[model samples]
Target: MTASMTGFAAHSLNLDHASVNIDLRSVNQRFLELHFRLGDEFRALEPQLRELINQRLARGKVECRIGLTMPPAATLDNGLNPDILERLAHWQADVLQRLPGSAPLSVNDILRWPGAVQTAALSQDALNEAALAGMRAALDELVESRQREGAKLKQHILDRLAAAEAQVAGLAPLLPALAAAQREKLTERLHEALGEAGHERLAQEIVLAAQKADIDEECSRLATHFAEVRRVLNQAGAVGKRLDFLMQELHREANTLGSKSVAVETSRASLELKVLIEQMREQVQNIE
Candidate 1:
């Protein structure tokens, strides 16, 4: 089944130590570009996360935001660096000896010094595993959303195809009548321009005129292209480009039909066909 290039998926996962919330949003793009927003602690997972998204998505500008919500229970003890503390103490003592009456460094001042306390370390492997699981779930949701939207787009295109086919069908039987009327009008005009003396030559001229204004070939090709479009729509995945090309072909045929129109009905049919093709083209742009 085909999918759309726009969707949104958000999922929150509660791991033993941390709760990970992932939000993924995508829109139509010519290529797959990913933007990731993650905390420093989760930076290690960026490459793997990108790889996971690339594997699932074929095209779009996808943005993924990862938020790690750590509860108070997950907070680790702030271990002081005893060696740095000792060095700071020695430096403070040396400064005090030089100034004799300088105030002693307070405990709060020592704790606030750079490198005095170490941040709690997390198990890289465990976090990586949890993040991957959450990411996979979020991606599945994204695909589901895209697929639902794609189904709607497919229906829209199919409806336009039906309308176009009906217009072509309506035009098919009118061609012969249109040509006959055009031939009659041409004969009358020729007879008025040149009297009975030019009857034979006038007949030849009418035939040539009818042949020049023939829309049979254009109408036939339009029907063929319509059939090809329906075939492509039913066949399989990633047919957006193919359908787009077919829409262009349909428009080309419609324009040719209009230019060669010998009757008002033919011109109207051509206009309707162009409208239907444009509608389908608009919807096809969002397909995957």
Candidate 2:
């Protein structure tokens, strides 16, 4: 199924020692680009997280953020280092003896000292595993959101495709008659300018006009491209790039049809085709 390039998902989990939160957001991009916002403790997992995203998504600018909050119990367990506190006290006493009138080191001053208070190191492996699980869940939600939006986009494109096909079908029958009328008009003009001598040249002018006005090839190729687009929409993997290429092809055919238009009706049909193709192109830009 087709997928849109815009989506968001967030998940939070409370473990025994810490609370983990993961948030993922994505927007349209021509290629896969990842932005990570993680704490220093989790920086080592960046590569793993990126690999996980790459496995599931083919295109977009994706941002991932992870946060960990230690629980109250865990926070208390490692709030102070008694060994560092004793060392600081000894250093402070020595400094006071040397300075004679130095004030005693205050609690605030000791607390601010490096290594005086340090949080217990949590298990890196456990944190990594929990984060990976949370990330996977968040990614699943993100993909589902994109898929829902994709369904809507696919429907819109299919409707436009139908409209384009109808325009082509309407123009098909009118082409031969329109070309014949144009050729007849050209012959009358030639006769007016050259009289009887123009009769011999009329046949050559008619053939040339018919060739110039012929849109059968353009229409047929458009139909083929439309079919391919529908097939790509139904595909399971990333088909955004393929659909983009098809849109270009469709536009090229529409342009050719417009240039060759010899009647107001054919020109209107071409204009409508262009409008529909443009709409589809806009939607394809957000597809994956």
Candidate 3:
């Protein structure tokens, strides 16, 4: 299935004392480019996260922003460390014995001591695992979003392909008639210029000129290219580049058809073909 290179996804992981929010966004690009916004604690996982995105996506400029929100001390499951408090109490008593008039330790002073309070926290391994899981979920949703957009783009491209085919078909039946009329006009002009004695030479020149103006080959290649486009759209995975190349080929044929045109209808059909091809190319820029 086709996939667009633009999408957005967000996922949050709530741990014991903190929550991690992962936001992934992508826009069309010629290659896979990753930008990460992770704090020092999560920086180690950047390479792994980039690898995960590469495994799923083919092309885009992707930005991954990780937001970490730590709960307040009031929300934490914390309490004073008994061992540290006891040691501090003993030290304070010794200090009071040495200096008889020394001030007593206040509640704030005791709480301010190192290791005086313990708060619930996740281990490094646990945090890494949770963050990775959240990233995976966000990546999955991003891919799904890209796929939904891709489906719409594919339909639009196919519709344009159908229109182009119709234009090619419409021009096919008119080719012989157009060539005959153009040849008659050319022959008449040649007769006016070269006179009756030059009939044989004029016939030969008309045949050659008619061959040059024949849009049959261009029209045929266009139809073939259109069929290839439909086939590519049906096949699986990363067909954007291929489709882009096909658009060039289609445009080339349309240009050839227009350049060699003799009839107003053929020129208009060529113009129409070009318009449809341009529309498809624009959409193909976002496909993957």
Off-target runs (Cα >4 Å) in candidate 3 are 73-120, 196-199
User: lDDT by residue for model 1 over 65-150, one digit each (tens)?
Assistant: 88766654544464677888899889988999999899998878876676565434546676677778989999999999999998
Order the candidates by TM-score, highest first — what do you get?
2, 3, 1
Backbone clash pairs for candidate 1 read: none
Task: Give the clash total for candidate 2.
Answer: 0
RMSD of each: 6.4, 5.3, 8.1
Model 1: lDDT of residue 246: 92
Candidate 2: give the clashing pairs. none
The residue ranges of model 1 lying beyond 4 angstroms of the native Cα positions read 76-121, 191-204
The CA lDDT at 203 in model 2 is: 76
What are the lDDT figures for the candidates, one per model?
0.84, 0.89, 0.88
What would you estimate as the lDDT of candidate 2? 0.89
Weakest 10 consecutive residues of candidate 1 by summed lDDT? 70-79
Candidate 3: the clashing residue pairs are none
Candidate 3: global Cα-lDDT? 0.88
lDDT rank order: 2, 3, 1
- The top-ranked prediction according to TM-score is 2
Higher-lDDT candidate of 1 and 3: 3
